[model samples]
Target: DVKVTQSSRYLVKRTGEKVFLECVQDMDHENMFWYRQDPGLGLRLIYFSYDVKMKEKGDIPEGYSVSREKKERFSLILESASTNQTSMYLCASSLYSGRRYEQYFGPGTRLTVT
Candidate 1:
């Protein structure tokens, strides 16, 4: 069974504090993505990594960064947490099959920044 697990299901952080969100996939997918889900904004991509140690900036990567040092793990880092950054973070992994790919998403991490 393919599974993606997040480090925390819920997190609370103070403004300006650094936060780390960890995600691990047992399927050994090559493509990993970090997305933030808001009330109306839906899912906005924050970052993605296609290969180990290779990262790419997504649609909204200004205040966030990602690390994929290992093939099965991906970490999303919030440089400085802010109230506006509070949202449900989702981690997904997919194969490199062009045009037809299905992403397996984690349960998600709901972060609240105060």
Candidate 2:
């Protein structure tokens, strides 16, 4: 089975503190995405990478960034985190081409910024 592991399941930080959320997938997929989920805003895409060192900004990329140094690992960075940034972070991996290109999501990292 394909597995996605995150560095932390929960995190708490003060406002203005920098945060890093790590994710790794074992499926050797070409596409990786980072999304933040809030109450009413739904799941908003933060960033996505199609290939190593290649990234694209999503709908809500204001205070977020991403890194894809390797094929299996993708990192999400929150520069100067704030209370508004507190939410559940999800990392998903998917193949770029297939009959079903559905994304497989990780367990998610709940971040609370106070």
Candidate 3:
């Protein structure tokens, strides 16, 4: 029973406008992650994808952009919305299964830019 689905929990954009955050994982995980959390510059991993079209770019990833065609779905893009790119946006799902892999979280999407 591993589920991570987040289309939006809360989002308010104004500056520049162009924001889309969506994530869904029904356990068929291969590895998918997109994170952003401020407060001390804590968890900051912008994009990740293990299969389905393939993608990898973590550690901020600038303005942010990501999309996984299938494999449960994962999309996060905010090309213009500024205000230092308001924080708290996280979506993760993992099943690497090599040594250490335990990530399942998607109850976040706070974004507020004005």
Worst 10 residues of 3 by lDDT: 93-102
Q: Write the per-residue lDDT of candidate 3 for residues 2-114, one digit (tens) a residue.
A: 98989989999999988999999998999999999999778989889988879999977988788888999999998889999988899999988776488999999999999
Residue 42 CA error for candidate 1 (Å)? Answer: 0.9
Cα deviation of 3, candidate 1, in Å? 0.1
Off by over 4 Å in 2: none
What tens digits encode model 2's per-residue C-alpha lDDT throughout 34-100? 9999999889999999999999999999998888999999999998999999899999999987765
Specify the highest-lDDT model's number.
1
- Our tally of clashes for model 2 stands at 0
lDDT of 1 by residue, 14-57 (tens): 99999999999998799999999999899999999999999999
Give candidate 1 regions above 4 Å deviation: 97-100
Preferred candidate (lDDT higher): 1 or 2: 1
CA lDDT of 2 in candidate 2?
Answer: 81
Q: lDDT (CA) for every model shown? A: 0.95, 0.94, 0.90
